[model samples]
Target: MFLLEKLFGGKSSAKVNAIKMLPAAYAEMVGDAGHCQLKRLHPALGVFELHFSTANGEKYACQMTACVAGVDIVFAANNRSVLVSPPFSLAKLRPVFDIALADR
Candidate 1:
């Protein structure tokens, strides 16, 4: 079985744990609420990538590295870079994890 510890934007622990239970190598989450594609970059490295976008046109490409509380995210947008933590919301940006996941 594969388990994911957490997911950004997921409101409750119950929901997060539910996502982890999906029997797939990678899970694709898309809905009116948002779009998120999650996959393990490397289990040992504890790295994962989350490509998510909200209802608007805002776009973000994020890389999450495993850390203590949760993963640390390196976010890139409008040619700008910033580091953020979990529970961060980008409800309007469009995530293209399929492409981002493939490029890495």
Candidate 2:
């Protein structure tokens, strides 16, 4: 639930590359359906969204917006009925960033 800049320095290429290397199962979980979800929620400007279903059938949605120094990420469950906003410094969110990279 952290921003990409906190771990990836706002490099879109790295993120895309990371996603391209995900395991097949995980990749499938975030396939076309998930891409549609993300597209539906992404802001016209500096925002990004992503959706995925877990192995147990639970679904998650993540929304992020670009900030001056970084991006702000919010995670939600149940189609965004529940939301959690977790702010991260540009160097403090590598794990989540890695997950995003793998999922993108």
Candidate 3:
């Protein structure tokens, strides 16, 4: 890994790829869950906890977890098992970010 980093300018390709894939991953994640607000649970850390209300007015939270392997967007209720884990294409990132941020 160190050798790969040294050859690749000190950053693992996996980490760079994952960072490049975040925004679209996040949009598809939040869009699939309907409307919701995302909050970074630990600002200094790389964790984000999403809060959204279900159709029945019940509240649920899901944490966005990312690592060198990849990013996992797990939708779960507080203190319970996972509700859903939607599949997304990492390659779709460029367009998503482009369209989503075109005005900005």
- What tens-digit string does per-residue lDDT give for candidate 2 at 5-99? 44543445333223222233344444444331343322223355555565556665555443332333332222332111233322233233344
**Model 3 residue 86 lDDT?**
24
Pairs of residues at least 3 apart in sequence or in different chains that clash in candidate 3: none
Assess every candidate by TM-score: 0.33, 0.31, 0.33
Candidate 2, superposed: residue stretches over 4 Å from native: 1-37, 41-44, 67-94, 97-104
Between candidates 1 and 3, the one scoring higher on lDDT is 1
Clashing residue pairs, candidate 2? 6-90
Tens digits of per-residue lDDT, candidate 1, 6-90, equal 3432324432332233212123345464555565644334355565556775545556543233454443433443444444334
Model 3 stretches with alpha carbons more than 4 Å out: 1-33, 41-44, 70-104
lDDT of each: 0.41, 0.38, 0.40
| Backbone clash pairs in model 2 (N, Cα, C under 3 Å; residues 3+ apart or in different chains), count | 1
Ten consecutive residues with minimal summed lDDT in candidate 1? 17-26
lDDT of 3: 0.40
Q: Pick by lDDT: which candidate is best?
A: 1
